[model samples]
Target: MPTSSRSSEGGTRRAAAAALLTPGLLALGVSFVVPLVWLARMSLNRTVGPAELQPDVSLSSYVDVLTDGFMWEVAWHTLWLGVLVTVLAVAVSYPIALFLARTRSRLRGLLMALAIAPLLTSSVVRTFGWLILLSDDGIVNSALSTLGIIGEPLTLTNNVTGVVIALVEIMMPYAILAMIAGFGRVSKDLEDAAGSLGAGRLRCFVRITFPLSLPGVLTGALMVFVLTVSAFITPRLMGGGRVFVIATEIYDQATTTLDWPRASALAVLLLLLFGVFLVLYQRLFRMVEGR
Candidate 1:
């Protein structure tokens, strides 16, 4: 073909690709970019009253959120909660994922179904179930007391511990599914070769299996971290107003105080903080993988 004809074909293909992507780009702008711009504008406004916001632009809200010691405490709490939930979810899911990956039992399908059954239920229902289980007179306390673990029912509900437990349960299935996919990609031949070379099961797993599965583990951890940090429902229900995280604070500011500007400011801060953490994490992971 002539160079002119090839160039024309390339231009046509580019035009067609751009045309096909236009609708998706427009939808993304409408759904995400527009709201983000509006949110940034709102965050700059001044709140004059409980239900009133002035059009005048200011940084008072940002200053208040950033400088306030209480806001810092809440941010710290949210951060640690996210970290704890991610750790627990990853720890709990890894073994289950390994089992699913290696099992040839006839009940594999049933086990997989059981593992993911929680996700099929509404989050509200799951949290409520945890509420009952962790309540003073609930099964956990009853069993612990029966085992002489404590004289009285320990305070499980309406606290950080309860929140952690519930969040772990919520994130476990996602971590497991991600790891299962990751484990599936790993070749069994490498593990067998290690065993044939006199490596113990644990040694083989530590040296061969675990490193190969790091991508899945990292993905699950990041997902759980993001979800836990941004979670409103689990914290609200499990914490029972005593435990205050950034999401709950934002909710209170927006709804109860009707301070949209302050809420928007808090949201903006949260997004920036999360973005920074994510970038740092990805860099660290890349560094580790490079080694």
Candidate 2:
């Protein structure tokens, strides 16, 4: 086709694409934007309980959520949990992922099955399992006591450590999956090429494999962080309701306390905190990926 004809066709295609996207844009606004706007408004409104949702707009909820030291502490606790879980999950799962990546077929399938089973289990059920294993008299303590490893059981339930472990268990599958995908994307030929050129395995990984898999690392870490930050059941159950995360707090405000405004304000704060990650992605990952 001639240059002019090509340009015209491209323009027409763009116009048609825009037209097709309008409905989706509208749906997005309705589904996400509308509730978000409602949430913002609710954040400003005064809420006595679930029943008393008045339109008397104010910042008391924001003030309350912000001024409370407990919320800040809870937020910090959740943040640390997310960071630790992300790091540990990635660190622990990478080797497994690499192993699976290298394995031919059947073993890879088995590893994949093991990695995915935890994810397939319900969160409540998983948390319950942790509770059984981590409680003072549970399997861990019984095993230790039987083995004479220690005189008594250690405290794992209703603690940060327990919560972190549960979160990590639940989130590690995603990390492994991410790493496996990442490793699949990396060409083994590159490692072979490096090896042929006198580069050792460690050197090959450092020089070639690590950098290429970073995108998957970024992706997996982000997914784990976001999920852990907003996680409700595992934290609540494993942490013994002492684990106060944004998601749990939101639940309490809206469901238990019947305080929608405060909940909405807390929700908005969660959104803002979550949005920081988008900023981080733009600044950090885009630079890494040369986007």
Candidate 3:
């Protein structure tokens, strides 16, 4: 073929590739970008209902969200829950992940299956399990009664603590998968080398294994934190309508109160915070990866 003909065919292929990307890019913009933009616009809109003909876009939503003591309290509650869940899940999963990584038995699949089985259960189902167990006349109470650990049942449900317990159960599986991936990627040769150099098990783990697994732990923690932050069913069921987080607040504002502007504003606020966290995580990850 002539040089010009070959060049023309190459350019035609490039054009076709760009054309194929256009639809995907357009869909992404419509589904994600457009909604984000609309939420941002609504955040600035203060219209309450059909009464207002023209909604003025301003900083009122942000001002309202920031000034409200209730929202701040709710935000604090959510963050505390996220942090507690992340810490506890990491603590619990560390050993289990290590066990899974080290074990080579046929039953290892069964053990790993147990961790993943909870994930297969719906969020509602998992929370409901906690609800049944934590109730005054439930299995936990029965076991305690039978064991004489306590004379009476404990009040475990209808509180933030109850909600946290359920959240941890569901979130821990996700954290485990992340840790397993991380630990699996780590070369055991390093650990063996450290051990041969006179390091004890604890030292090898702390100095080599733990440091190398930091990326996994960090990513897993972040994933658990974000999921717990947005999770609504567990909190709604276990909190007994007494506790409110940002997600629950969004639900209440949009559904119960029929406040679109407020809901959108709250959503925008959440997205802003999420963006801040993502940026922070990226920077922190870079530092860790550099090490």
lDDT of 1 by residue, 150-208 (tens): 99898989999999999999999888887787565457899999999999989998898
Q: Which whole-number lDDT from 0 to 100 does residue 249 have in model 2?
A: 86
| Pairs with backbone N, CA or C atoms under 3 Å apart (clashes), candidate 1 | none
Residues 39-71 of candidate 3 have per-residue lDDT tens digits of 777667775554241377777767877899999
Winner on TM-score (2 vs 3): 3
Candidate 2 on 46-112: residue-level lDDT in tens?
Answer: 8665558778879999999899999998788878888999898888887787777777776777778
Instruction: List TM-score per model, in order.
Output: 0.90, 0.85, 0.88
Candidate 2: RMSD over Cα atoms? 3.2
RMSD of each: 2.3, 3.2, 2.8
Q: Which stretches of model 2 miss by more than 4 angstroms?
A: 1-31, 48-53
Clashes of 2: 0
Taken over the whole model, the C-alpha lDDT of each candidate is 0.90, 0.85, 0.85
Can you list the residue pairs that collide in candidate 2?
none
**lDDT (Cα, 0-100) at 238 in candidate 1:** 95
Where does candidate 3 stray beyond 4 Å? 1-27, 48-54, 107-111
Error of 1 at 196 (Å): 2.5
TM-score (C-alpha) between model 1 and the true structure: 0.90
